[model samples]
Target: MVFTIKKVINNNILCVTDAGGNEMIVTGRGIGFGHKAGQPVNSDAVQKIYHMASMPVQQKLMDLLEQIPYDHFLLTDELVSEIRKKIPYTLNEGLLITLADHISFAIKRKEQGVEFKNPLLESIREYYPEEYRMGKACVQRIQEKLSVDLSKDEAGFIALHIVNAELNTTMSITNDITRFVDGCVKVVESYYGRTFDHESLAFSRLAVHLRFFAQRLFQHEQESDDSMQDQDFRRLIASSCKEHYECAKKIAAYVAETWNQELTEEELLFLTIHLKRINLSSEQTTK
Candidate 1:
């Protein structure tokens, strides 16, 4: 199938429309060196073709590729491919462009010796271990392949980006969730007058619960009729575990002040149960 060139981005990349009218970014050595718009692209010379579903994403990739060195794009693609192999979930195709954009900027920052610490690294490491580990490995690969050294904290940023792409969420929302989880931990520690072991299974469970809790809160989902039975059971637990319920209320207050959103009764009940579980485990360890 013949692809008509729509834009000659550079010597290495060409924006083309395939025979089916699908916009694609075709990359090859000297592919666009002597090309012009409306000219037929040399099919034999094409090395990579990115068939994007969204025009905005395609444009974003094109714009990014135009700005950064082609080597950055190549390294970003390799990193994305490695991450996809290690992760269990499927990543969004848009990650191709976003990751490249982030890596290119990071590379420039590294060259200039700028410090870009991810404040949420501790939370990410504790809560999202797999993504965190994958991120570290990715950065190591980046250092080896591109000779750009990034801090371990930068791995946290990359992990969040991966999670954001996987969840089809924005980086802002993912960071907010990280902050929310951190706040929950602070509330628990302050309320109990002690810190729980981050590596504890109970702590991991709490972190997972809080992640989903934050997601539900952000989505502003109302209680469904099917949850009435579960709600009743949780209310029973809340009544029995008054101390835990009080701690849960403090967490809700933190959520309110930080996120400006009130938690539902269902959320409070679930938070109480998770808090109780963590508290009990901590107490047992200290005994």
Candidate 2:
């Protein structure tokens, strides 16, 4: 399909408006050379087309591209492709804008020797080991290709952005979820006087549960008590696994007070059961 050029970004990149009137960023070698607005670009010559999820993100990316070298854009595109292969979930298109813009700024800072440290790097590595590893690999790639060295802290930021893309959530919400899980895990560890295996299947399940649990809290969604009226069943489990139930109660209170959202009985029940398994497994191993 042919695209009408809206603006020429450079010799290799151009802002083109598709037939449907939506503005898109397209790039190819010499595609914009001698091109002007209202000019038509042959689809065959276009190598990459970035359809940003929102205009604000698109504008930010465009503004960044105007200041940074074209290599940054190409590097960001390659990184996104590599990250997609490493991740299990579908990444949102917004990653193109968000990640590209971030890399551009990071490169600029690196060139100027501006040091910015990420305080949550350890938390990210602990909670999202896979993504953090991917992020580290990305740093290596950037160093090799662009001759820019990004710190491990930047890797943490990249991993969180990857998480945001995978979850289709904003960076703020992703950070909130990461902190929420970290806090809850700390509570469990402190209560049992032991650390849970982050790689174990039980711990993975618990992390997944917390991911969704935090999502609900962020969205202000709650389970109705009317549907979970089986107080006797909950009480039976709580009575039998009193210690685990109490631990879960403490966690529930933590989430409630921290997020200002009450945890439903069903949530408390499932959390207690999961913690019971974790606690039992740890005890068995210790004995």
Candidate 3:
């Protein structure tokens, strides 16, 4: 489809409108170098087209394009491509703006020798391993392409941004979920009097479950416990795994007290099963 250039954002980026008059931002090397409004965009020069449905988001991206270096936006675009290939999630288009803004600021901070420590770094690494690995790759790419080396803390920060985009939530909510999961894990550890090995499959499973559990809690969602079979299973778990069931109760209590959200029998049942698995794994590791 032929795109009419609405405005030139930079030498590499242009704001264009299609035949239907839907606005989109297109980017490529020198795509807008000599382009002007009312001209047809060189389709061959368009490397990536960002269609932001929200006008505010589109305007924010345009503002970022004008404020930050185009090269940073290009780097973030490349990273977003990599994330799409690696993760099986439909990320929000807002990632382009959030991540590009972050990278630009990170580079400037590096230049000024100013570094911010990510308080959630460890929890982020443990909770979102895939996204954290992608974040590390992003850091390495930045160093290779821009000659600026960023700390692993920045990788954690970037992972949170990825999580934010994936959940279509704010960064604050994503961080809260991470923190909530970490707190639940600690509660389990405290009750068991030992720490579960982070690399253990059981720990991974528990972490994944808790992450979603926290998300549901934050979103005020609850699982249905109306099924008689589900009730039977919950009873079976409570009987078969008494210790783990008690721990799950503790976690449920903590969630109720902290988040003011009550867990349904389904959540409690799943938590009991995960706790049982973690206990078994811990025993095997010790033996």
Highest-TM-score candidate = 3
For each of the candidates, the C-alpha root-mean-square deviation to the true structure, in angstroms, is: 2.4, 2.4, 1.8
Instruction: List the candidates ranked by lDDT, beginning with the highest.
Output: 3, 2, 1
> On residues 150-201, what C-alpha lDDT tens digit does candidate 3 reach at each position?
9999999999999998878888889889989998998998999987899889
Instruction: List ranges where model 3 is wrong by over 4 Å.
Output: 225-229
> How well does candidate 1 score on lDDT at residue 243?
94
After superposing all C-alphas onto the true structure, candidate 3 shows an RMSD in angstroms of 1.8
Instruction: Indicate whether candidate 1 or candidate 2 has the larger TM-score.
Output: 2
lDDT of 2 by residue, 180-261 (tens): 9989999899988878877776777788788778877786775655655788988898899999899999998898788777
RMSD of 2: 2.4
Per-residue alpha-carbon lDDT of candidate 1 for residues 98-183, written as tens digits (9 for 90 to 100): 88888889889989989787778888998888889988987998899988888998899888988887767778888888888888
- Candidates in order have lDDT scores of 0.84, 0.85, 0.89
On the 0 to 100 scale, the lDDT of residue 148 in model 3 is 95
Model 2 quality (TM-score): 0.89
